[model samples]
Target: MDLDMAQVRAFVHAAQEMHFGRAAGDLGVTQQALSKRIGRLESLLGTKLFERLGHGVGLTEEGRRFLESARRALAASDDAVATIAGKDRPLRVDVWGHLYAPTRTLLQVAGRADELRLELGHGRDLPGAMTALLRGDIDVALGRIHPPLSPGLAHRLVRLEPVDAVLSTDHPLASEPTLRPEQLRDSVLWAPGALERLDFLRRFADRFGVRERSGSVNLGLAHFLTEVAVDPRRFSLVPADMPLPDIPGLRSVPLVDPTPLYAWSLLWRTGSTHPGLSTLAAACAGEAGRSRWLEYDPTRDWLPDLPTDRAEAHSG
Candidate 1:
């Protein structure tokens, strides 16, 4: 079957999003234009590609089978371009972060001028980052995956850190090294919208019948810290490992019962041809970035012990 690179790539993206409008937005194309292109490709293939489900779309069985081949074709095209351009030269890549640590490591590793010309974009949340990735506006994304990733995106789990309830050190609960969800009902809770969809938080909130009452706060981490710090009586929960300021007497206690753990990952478009991205993916899979964090306190990660490379100690 004859196929053009652009149409195949567009089809793969639309299938991944399962919405023509969203897919077009990701590709930076108008919905009408994207529709015409898909129509052209469908005509060439002599099959219907999507079933419009009133408000959205779904792939036909044939579209499902064609998706992987289309992605591979795009990857091959990227490889061919990279070969013509030479790998030794700096590569251009885009990365987005929405208050996740994996995002920081991605920027630190990819932004090195010697290896890559990295373009850094910051989003307020995971949806925004994923949208940018699908649109090809960003090549890599450092973000959260509460529901996990869709088929066309690749994810590498980097770290799983516990959550802490931030409050004034003088608060009654501050003295305790850890506090359970049931014990936190009396304290004012601050729920950042970005984390609202997180499984741990949702589960914990549901158990206590406190999900509806929780106030939505700023999505940005720095703003979150400032708001909580300013209000001595109010508290916000965040990843326990993220550094916070000691404002005279502010303290953070680990949430015991819920033990909310944030799963961070490095996400990239599956068809990436950039050699540096592949290197980063392999390194992350090997957990090369784990050793850089504060010495793993057993109190934090309760998992069975795993060995890490000492070389990672000095790399970061």
Candidate 2:
């Protein structure tokens, strides 16, 4: 029996979200239409795929079993279509954080600039983009990967650059050749919206007694500079190589005591077979290989010694 692709898409989306309303919204269809499509699919399969649970829904036993098969079928169908089409139409890419400038330059220099159909998401945040990739919302995502990466995800390191402290010109520390991590004690550090979620930063904050303040979601470089310019007490950390806006009042100072490095990676689902993904990954790898400044030495000790817990607790 031939299955309707639209019905399959609706079922897959509904199964992923576990909420008919959200699933319908994602699919851009009304709840009534989504329900009808799912009903039709269940009738065709001759099994109840989902069971309503109070305010939400969940997959039935049959659905739990069918989900794997359904995913495989959908993937195979997508591959078949891509193969027949002769060209991958649009390769959706999600870029995380303020790394867009460097990423774009790398792609352009690598001669794969045309491959990106950019759908930038969750700037400087990886979790949201990772969720999107797992849900098949995008073909690829570029961002930093914290340790303990999920099993279904595959990643390739694209670049590593030193982290710098962005300070207002009027700030006392602005003219310092470099600031030590300890100098930031009692100071409010401006972090990208999701930067605080990094385990390293959490540990660092607890260790160094630095207070972190995050700006609005997806804050761009221009706005970030503006925030720093207006507030002398505010500071931010970013990749040293990241292109900064020409805002006269802002300066990026190197962090020296414990040199932190920001790593960027190309991420995709482990079993993804999108041709564009392969090409893009190769291009990124090539650009990284040729770049003199992006190499990272894993064995080097980069963090400063943490003070005792008593000292840290006593610190303001």
Candidate 3:
């Protein structure tokens, strides 16, 4: 027997959702019915698409390869049906986050006259957004990385934002133009609750000598600065060029010693034939709005002037 469109649709939906019940809900069917359909499809294909891992389901390595083909097939099928039905629709691509403002400017520069429409999505950070990109939920991601990225992913530097030691305006250090690393040795910091960032914190702490730390993901940059502003005893590292919040109590003082800098990049799956990827890259690297990370010097080689976005060095 041949695998029908319905079966393939269910398989693809299951892979994306990673939950039998949710996939069934998406398809307007019972979990049992969806399970049977997926099983039948797997039997026809002679390979399992998912692995039962505790309460959740994960795609097998083979399933990952199949997903790309499945997505392309579905897209083609949709295009054919739309053509036959005499309906025209826009191609959709997803963008995530504030890390890459140049991307937005590029899209706007293309003007509304262009045929392509971009759909933007926001996320907490690069890691969360990149996961969505991998699952085919989103097309592109603009995120920050210390170094090192996944093997099959590609990225280009968008900017090299410098970090500053932000504190309350009344704080003594705030009056200074720049602060030394030793100034922060005995200072307290409000840190993110994420475990993934803990290693970075430890390394930074050892280098700068952070004496006290508090873990609170609930506190955003605004709140962290607020605490410092009110008490004048706490501080947090913030991007140097990032506009200091309008709140009267806060100010960002540059860290002169051990100045930490971060690279923001655009990421995409290498094998992806998605048109949006190239469109995004061109926009980001446009003539007027080239990546902010580039050091524009008339004498320097333009190619090497930009920060390296090689995947191996960015993988975390």
Highest TM-score: which candidate? 2
TM-score of model 2 vs. true structure: 0.76
Clashes counted in candidate 1 amount to 1
lDDT of 3 by residue, 187-254 (tens): 77756565345444455666667767765654555665666677576777666766656777887787
Name the best candidate (by lDDT): 2
- Model 2 C-alpha lDDT per residue in residues 154-177, reported as the tens digit of each score: 776665557778888888887899
Query: What is the C-alpha local distance difference test score of each model?
Result: 0.62, 0.68, 0.62
TM-score of each: 0.67, 0.76, 0.69
Order the candidates by TM-score, highest first — what do you get?
Answer: 2, 3, 1
Candidate 3 lDDT for residue 2: 55
lDDT tens digits by residue: candidate 1, 155-201: 66555556678877657777887877667666666656534554445
Clashing pairs in 1: 26-135
Model 3 residue 201 CA deviation (Å) reads 5.4
- Cα displacement (angstroms), candidate 2, residue 307, comes to 27
Clashing residue pairs in candidate 3 are 147-314, 148-313, 148-314, 148-315, 148-316, 149-314, 149-315
